[model samples]
Target: MTPVFQPGQTVVRREIMRGEPWIAMPQVCVQDDGDLLVTYTPGGTPMVYPETGAFPVGEHPWKLAGSTSWRGHGRLELHWTGVEHSIFLFWDGPQRAFQGWYFNLEDAPRRTPIGFDTLDHELDVWWAADAETYEFKDVVEFEETGPARYPGRMEQIRAEGDRIARLLDAGELWWDKAWADWAPDPSWQARTMPDGWATVPFEAR
Candidate 1:
């Protein structure tokens, strides 16, 4: 927790699925104020793994996606202390237009020497820029992976999703247009991984 990172410093933000490394990738640190850590990855950043070689694509990627060239939209991740969910803003294209808000339901982010680790609790809530139309993203994936991923946390995951929905209904939430309008430094545009990104163990707190 004492390790401090500078803006543009590269670190590995790994997902600890089933207590082992699932997906790892390099992210440029935007800020780290102990409580709120912000990081971003340009579109097309490479995905790394603790183990070398190809990772097979599965039916449920959120469960276990293969290590391919990351074809997803460029994203900025907001990790606040002790929050049940983290907000990720996604954008694509040359204009880097605002896309949508993805509320990822996960355990509290566990700080690590490299960066942060968290077990992504399958079910998530997402809304477009309008925020008027919202939908749960991975119900099918959750049904298939939740029980096996974490034995007793499925009910808690459902409750957390409901809680977020309630807040969205009341218009009470942490992020808004301000966060959505963020733009990254042009210098951080390179799609690369850090020094130890592939070997940083997915140690859960």
Candidate 2:
């Protein structure tokens, strides 16, 4: 009961099979309500909680408010703190597409200092199961870093995404046109990770 966004809003994230839309800006603590206590449950020490590589994994895992669900399927882990991430998904019994994994935090050739390796970082994932979107941006031109943790320097995130895509191609505002429309489509093919994760159980959907 604590999820609300404002600052330039438009977070229509509908993920089902391949329709990943964007536009969610307003930086600096972006309207923090403690971001729902750091994305749920005792999770309130932020630093982007590994930059949004969310995880918990089964039988009520952490229920990011997706309600309650499970039939048979589990796997969750996304780590982004300077960039380097991974995603795994499953749930198909009540019709939630299925199968997912998209990571390319800069040529993920299994780079690990702790956990995460299987770098097929070519960056390609986009799922839009009717309207339940999923998006992971970064076209290509590898060499990434600068969420700032260590090996940070993808040419300084391409000179700060080319100075925010030249101020949204000169419109010069609106949060740099929401970071140049944050073109994300990476690719995933499954559905329903939201309806409160359907009771979260069957191995943590």
Candidate 3:
């Protein structure tokens, strides 16, 4: 069955299974009658993208609340593109570590590689907004286990997260344009170009 999407409505959509293509979990979902009213007004309701597939930006600004690190309170922005992208800065209360989650459009999110003691560590967890699975990455050296497998099962998941973060930071998905200015040296222009060809006159020499 085709999924219906309304501009001002909230719905719960999830894939049938993990790693498999996300399918809309076809359970009856009701709009929060109260939420719809306020959402249309000045303050809008938070929308959840069909977790079955990649979600567009603006789906949820409240997801980082579930993070376990530093009480895990933060916000992630899924830019204009429908990719898992966000910039998160949080405090680790127990460890007293300052951390940041920088998501590049192409690379997995990368933890702050600087500004911390070598003994300090960072663990990043991403709940697939679609699949009911959790992925994690940790930035620390290992002793018993090689750096390749300290987090064990969570290793692959963390690598993927880091890769995606790199892509987002590089602006691979959406490139913003900037302007540059070039001014020619008055004296240099006169010597380089033919006398009549140069538009600006020499101020020196």
Candidate 4:
């Protein structure tokens, strides 16, 4: 059974494949409506990424080689139930200046005993800080490494990008500029992953 999170509660988000976590981030939950989960992590939050020096980023997560702190913008992650992708709203600096939106195309998040797990598709879309201009990100990474990594799902991933592009074009999904004003609670401290975060059981993408 999945546990419900209260506002301001810290939960771990993990990227998993084949029963191992590739990366982990400790995020503070802002809202949970059963269908969607809104979470936040301020800039400088300690996080972990898959450690791959010569190989691609996702190549070695369980190893926890790329331990680093979240930088630049604090992200409000929007994870919709069963959706293939999640959107992130970014704010930078001490004043919490709103940056923009990021469409992270990935596998749908699966609720876990602790938090949630998903796989990054390597393709993403981004809107400028003012929301005036937009562009697709990680296209080359997706094209170069995706086909070989995801097997026959290359087209599926590209199609997901197309789907997100259409949403951006239609101004749907996290397109609201009002979210720019959203800020993390002042009393909240930077969240870090749990001691056994990587040990969290993977539920498959």
Best by lDDT: 4
Task: Give model 3's TM-score versus the native structure.
Answer: 0.24
Q: Residue 204 deviation, candidate 1, in Å? A: 3.2
lDDT of 3 by residue, 20-66 (tens): 21111111112122211110101111222223333222222233343
Q: Write the per-residue lDDT of candidate 1 for residues 24-95, one digit (tens) a residue.
A: 677888887887788887767776655543333322263354545556556788888888788888887778
Better of 2 and 3 by lDDT: 2
**RMSD of candidates 1 onward, in order:** 3.3, 19.3, 24.8, 3.4
lDDT of 2 by residue, 1-205 (tens): 2234443322212111011111111111122232120011111111111112222221111234433322342222332333333233333444534444332233221211111122222333433334354454555424342222123344543553444345435654321113212211223112222232212221110
Q: Between prediction 1 and prediction 3, which has the larger TM-score?
A: 1
* Worst 10 contiguous positions by lDDT, candidate 4: 53-62
How does residue 118 of candidate 4 score in lDDT? 87
In model 1, which regions exceed 4 Å deviation? 52-67, 195-202
Per-residue error for 47 in candidate 4, Å, reads: 1.9
Whole-model lDDT per candidate:
0.75, 0.27, 0.26, 0.76
Which lDDT tens digits does candidate 4 get at residues 35-126? 78888887778767644323333464334455477766578888888788888887766776777778898888788777888888879989
Which structure is stronger by lDDT: 1 or 4?
A: 4
Per-residue lDDT for 193 in model 4? 72
Report the C-alpha displacement of residue 147, candidate 3, in angstroms. Answer: 16
